[model samples]
Target: MQSQDVARRPAPSSPAGPVVEVEQAEAALVEHYPRLVRIAYLVLPSRMGRCRRVLTAHSLTQRALPRARTPAPAIPSRPAGRDGDPGYALVRLQVVRTALEAGLPLRRRAWPKRAQLPSPLPQVWGLKLFPRSGGADELALDQRLSALSGPARAACVLRGLERLPDGDVREVLTAAGVADADAALAEADRGGAEHRLLDSAEFDPCSLQARPTDLLRRRRRLNATLVAGAALAVCGALLGPPGDGWGPDGAAAPPYARNPAAQAALDPGRLTRVSPTAWRTSARVDFSVWPARGDLTDDTALLRRALAVWARPGGSVQVSATPGTPSGGPAGPPQLLYAGTVDNARVVILHDGLRIARYAEPADGTRGAALDFARVDGAGRAGSSAVVLGRTDGNVRYLTAPWVRGAGERDLREPGAAATDIALTGGVTPPLPSPALTSGPCTSWNVLQLTDGTGTRLVTDLGELVPAGLTAGRPGAAEAAAGAEALRTWAPFACSLRAVRSAGVRSVNAWAFAEQPLPDAGGSAAWVCTRAETWRGGGARVLAQFHTPGGRFGAVTARAEDVPACGAREPRVLAGVLWKSGAGTWYLLAAGSRDTVSVRATGGVEGSARGRLLTVRAEQGARADLKGTLEDGRTVSGLR
Candidate 1:
């Protein structure tokens, strides 16, 4: 039965079939295990011990691949056709490589540890061989490897180190070993410009060593100091000094100290006392005395008060002494004597009915004697000039200088004619016209007289006044007539006149006239006039006639425009007459002129008549008519 069962088992297939399958699987896994380990290394580079464990497990799996007892579970079916198996393997390899490049983890142990070892050659070859997985894992692995000393650190860093791109890696390795190889691994995956990537890798180790920790700390301290100093400076500037008082330059001078007291006791205008005898009374008088007897020192108050009594405007005081028997000494009545005080001195007044004398001396020996003389009658006038005892003809003729010898007197008389009793009491002066008044007709007139005995008078005519002057001739007579007709033309409106003269002129031409105030009212009024001759001479001429209330006259020549005119050239001369009183006084009387006529009857036919007469003639021809009363008062006459 065993022979027959064996015959039916189909002549056992070669043992090699299962062995070939195992071998193939082992080969494929071995080919890919390094890449898987690289992935695991990238993912857990900081846990290198774990990565080594994963790599070990992956190696074990590969080894066990060749020892499988039954066909390995159909070698997991692939998505592609059976013919695509090799391609699938290749694709899987590529995927694992990409994962390694992306730094993904894989289930591997010792392989990852082995993969971390550095290669000696330029990394470019290794990079091409396992470009994706090996390059990245190598950098991370190298960073861990850097912890080892010398040869070990060098071995790991340089192993795959040269696989880096072109730039700074070479230079970096020349100076220092890689200290942060993991960062290099990250840079490699990013695929940055090859030179920049390498440059960064190259400088990484040195940069770590070169960083200045102390300098950073110092910079922080400096910043803090600067901020603190700035704050202090600002606080100082704002708060200023701490006390309430003036600074060094008097910036806060006390204002209260500068004001003066309102009621100061010292008298500013009084003179300093020179001697005990020199004294002043409250009445503002200074006086001194000589030949004084008892010292005035103890009695200053009493003396000052005594001086005040006499200093009043209308005070009178007397000094007398006991009468004594007469001796044949001087031929005067009993010599009247009195003791009095003058300033700080004791004084004596010796009086005769006609004269009085004052003598003073300081009670103390400090001052000299003084003497003063005054008339007893009290009629003598006090003056700056020499005091005359009487008029030049008086018997008691004496002249004494006031204080000084030659100070002259000032005359205070006002000038003008003296007023007569009638004029003075009546308050009016009699009117007197000029003896040489112009014959026939006069246009205008003004008169002035003086009040004192100076006897000055002024008279002026009121005609010939012109607007700009006669220099600007009158408008055409027709125009003048028209203007006159347009308004009511009157003789008084023709011109204005004023005259000023001295106390001598007796007669003058009739012209425009005006009366103006005396320059000073105390003086006489000035009568001013402009003569027809002035206009005819082609220039303005003014006569100044001065007159006093006493009826005297004088003449002076002055420019006329300086004198004011009335109606002269004012366009509208309303019906009015201007009258001037005493001086500088004027009034306009609204009145018209009146006319007077005288008539006489001659011996003739007796007649009385009243009728209107008329005659008519051509512009160029002459016509005549006559009418009158005959002696009998009947109508008479005719002409052709």
Candidate 2:
């Protein structure tokens, strides 16, 4: 409760004491800010947590200066200290003293010190800050220091950070109001860390790594606000004049706004409706040329409801979007592709250049309306022509492009099966089957076979607003899956599309890159690499599948996301899988594209072979690194 230590040597310039001016102390704090903050951070108790310590350290250092010119303790910091400024020594001591006080616990009987309370300045929100992490040794040292008392922590900081001798540390600790400076010094010397470790960046508050706090929580709160706002707007619309709303928009709660862009997006009159004969005369073959179909296209009430819902859907609407597809409203007026009653629900399809949006409401009411979005950027001729209209029971209908002459459904599993005719009524095909919508076991994947001027290609519904095109063969030269050979190639891996069901896939291509002879005179195996290209260009997924002669379904050996491995840009691929022989012994089987000159395995099992194949004995479930050298002498790692 009492101080026993005194300053041994006062500043030589001042006879009475080290009386410092406000400007001098301010200058010292600014010049040595990082070092001073580091000392305070190390001195503060670990219980304060890293984020709080960061703010407190800065607060203490800034509050260290005297109000006016006043006398400071005439203490000599150290003999050979790097900081020769007396101002720095005075301010450093003040920072350490206040930081220690902040760590003291509040008592009911005693009022706390000003420093003990949370610092009012340097307030931070929505982010957590921490010192840059250090190596293991620094972490160990930090744990050791955390066990020490506040005064002992100050002693260690003074001795290591300021390089002060034991005597000087004792004097500083005593002046900082430690009850027993000798005991504090003893505790620090016994359990304290290596002095140099205290200087690590882990203890520095000036350098920090910052990250947002509770992002998921923030997003949930934002969504809740939007829902509340929608409810309020609906009430206002009912009570207010009819001119307030564009129309009675079903499932579309127009947000409370007067923004010009929002008004333009909600207005049905501004929607672009292409003529039924536009695609025949247009140069490009994409959704932009598709004619607006459906009997409800001329109904302004229904059209207004669809546009308003598409622009700002209510919380009650079941909104779904394929992965990587933007669910936000169109940037400007979007083109109307179709608007009509399909099955028991009224469906409307709208297309922006990047994505297609479909809105559907129950035939009875708008209570159970649904909205769906799918990315279709950069679509080409082929199967990009048809879009799903609505699904009734187990059957799905599609609104096709005007350029298409006939429509049919083909079961991909049966390569030679006769195509079943799906009669088209005003460019809308009758519901056949939707494979992506099935659950339980593997059955059949039927795709819409559209026969246009170019040729017939297959488009499969992927549980989105739009369907993805199917193709087979080597990367850049892949053709439509309508051919017998292409159909056979797609049959085995057709179920693998489940992995990328809602991944915004524009097209999927299967390529049989290699047929390798199994180890120990076993049957040959087919190595196929399949890629699902996304409309966003970046989310392509590649999988290396291995299949035996009689295997009905191929097994995926390796897979990767957002990589160009099996695409046209990078056609070469290498993959390895551990196979169990009839005798139960494990062998590492690997294969690469025909361009591969040699294959090698390392780590758990090591082997190298000329040409594109490799086989080596390996422990069961053992993992090995595989690589291949192309004919051009470039190395490629095995797909993972």
Candidate 3:
């Protein structure tokens, strides 16, 4: 690049430059310029037209790339792939942050209040690595991009296109002036970019054509404006104050300077409206005292709540406080206390402690978990609360502090948690109730059980518990133990009874399979349980359980030694419970010392284990039957 080009470049401020560091930074940028350009173009298209996007992207990339700032010491050389390298990830995240910042101020232009027609698709420019355009609707994709505010759009692009995880996504979004990082993720999910992003083919960078002459002209005009403004400032300082000003103190002319009638048309003190941006800058206002109206001045809770709302990161809230007139005596400036983002800096309003509003910003890691805020009472006694903030997926987190560090009396969610929506009931006592846990649904449970052979292992799901003394060498016990383990691993445990759907009109159906990783059973064998459920009436319930000591892993191909006796030729039924909510059919079979009869079981599979397998069967009108197998191999089938 020529010396003239360097002088004219509009990159953001850099550290005091040495020749060696500058060269290295420049080299690194030039090497990955294409990738950086693509990132900026995708995120900034709305802010600048296609032609300008190219020029502006180059400028932002220069400003954003970490190496471009302080290459020698601060940033390491780019890694082979950024997937695993923390340094590379941080650098990329910085680019995203800078890009978001650059676009936030210009989002309104891209998304104008008065409806504007969408630009024609631009032609592809420097790169072709963008994904092929297919499987997604172009119009819908465009709408999704348009709907997002600048910060949310940056988050979606970085997460979907860059594949950065939640932590990185949160950092970039928070730095980009997004009020809530989780909310931004939710916005991305709603736009269908949570998993996939629009392909590179969808973006047409070259459609917007720009000439060098236009940029040169615009730069020249900007220079002229700055010069004129400087000249005016110097002239004003040199000139004497105007004699005909608002007051003798020489206060600047009001907004309606041109027309005296317009200035006097409305009461400037009583009525005032401010833009969201204006609230961020520090300023003082002399508001009207409307005691009858019962506004901020008359209500302490409302005032404190409003201050907390405005204190959120990237958040803005307008406030109007009544200033006393000469009749009430001289009014002191009301001190405004806000929670700062960089540190836990608390500003106390010593003059009557007019404003001691407390608030907390959403954050993560150890620092976020242990954050604390203090609340000073009227008597100077202080109460503080520890803040716990975390979120799953893309939603705002509402946590309750069951106990505070020093003030263990009240349960609170930091001061700012409920500040966004506050209601004052005009009672002296502060309302502090038990905090509710916001850690999502309580269905999933983790249970650890001791396996006789080795270390303790995790049981995957909830199921019927096996009786004690069921172990190896015990008749009909090892099979039962294995069956329970299998059930824990694979059965779909439903929290509510309503979740089970009626098994179609079939008499008996295999509803689910219970399978567990085998310990000593050879490479291909696994302990499996085939659960059959009965469908009658309007609901379905488990009817019989068949446990296989070791079966082929997928039931696709089975070996001779894998299946037990009952499952060898046909499906098996073990000793299991059979009950219905109302009227149902039942049958019993047993072996006795003398009685003998021919019997055939349709749905039940026979097991080889020999032990007392007790069962009960009943019908609405028929008497309950009792059956038992005698010590001898004879049959005592059924007794009613």
Pairing residues by index, what is the TM-score of model 3? 0.25
- Candidate of highest TM-score: 2
Model 2 agreement with the true structure over 1-640: per-residue lDDT tens digits? 1112212222122222567798988888898888889888888877566888899998988888878886655556663543456677778778877877777655556766778777789887888788988999998888898888777888888888778888877766766667677988888888756888877889888889886754434564477679979999998877687574556667754657466876787778998988877778888888998888888888788878888888788978877777667778888888899889897688989998888899998654565688888878777776468888887535788888888899888888777897898789999987777887666587778888899998988888876667889899999999988988888888888888888776778889999999988776678989999999888789898999998777788899999999889889999999999998767879999999989999999999899999999989999978999999999989999999
Q: Backbone clashes per model, in order?
A: 88, 0, 9
Candidate 3 Cα deviation (angstroms), residue 553: 74
- Please tell me which model should have the higher TM-score, number 2 or number 3: 2
Q: Give the candidate order by descending lDDT.
A: 2, 3, 1
Ranking by TM-score: 2, 3, 1
**Which residue pairs come into collision in candidate 3?**
122-207, 123-207, 131-200, 572-605, 573-605, 591-636, 592-634, 592-635, 592-636
Candidate 1 is scored at a TM of 0.12
Model 3 residue 508 CA deviation in Å? 82
Which residue pairs show collisions in model 2? none
Q: Where in model 2 is the C-alpha error above 4 Å?
A: 1-261, 583-585
Q: What Cα-based lDDT does every candidate model obtain?
A: 0.27, 0.81, 0.32
- After aligning candidate 3 to the native by TM-score, how far in Å is the CA of 111 from where it should be? 23
Better of 1 and 2 by lDDT: 2
Candidate 2 lDDT score relative to the true structure: 0.81
Lowest lDDT 10-mer window, candidate 2? 1-10
Per-residue lDDT for 54 in model 1? Answer: 41
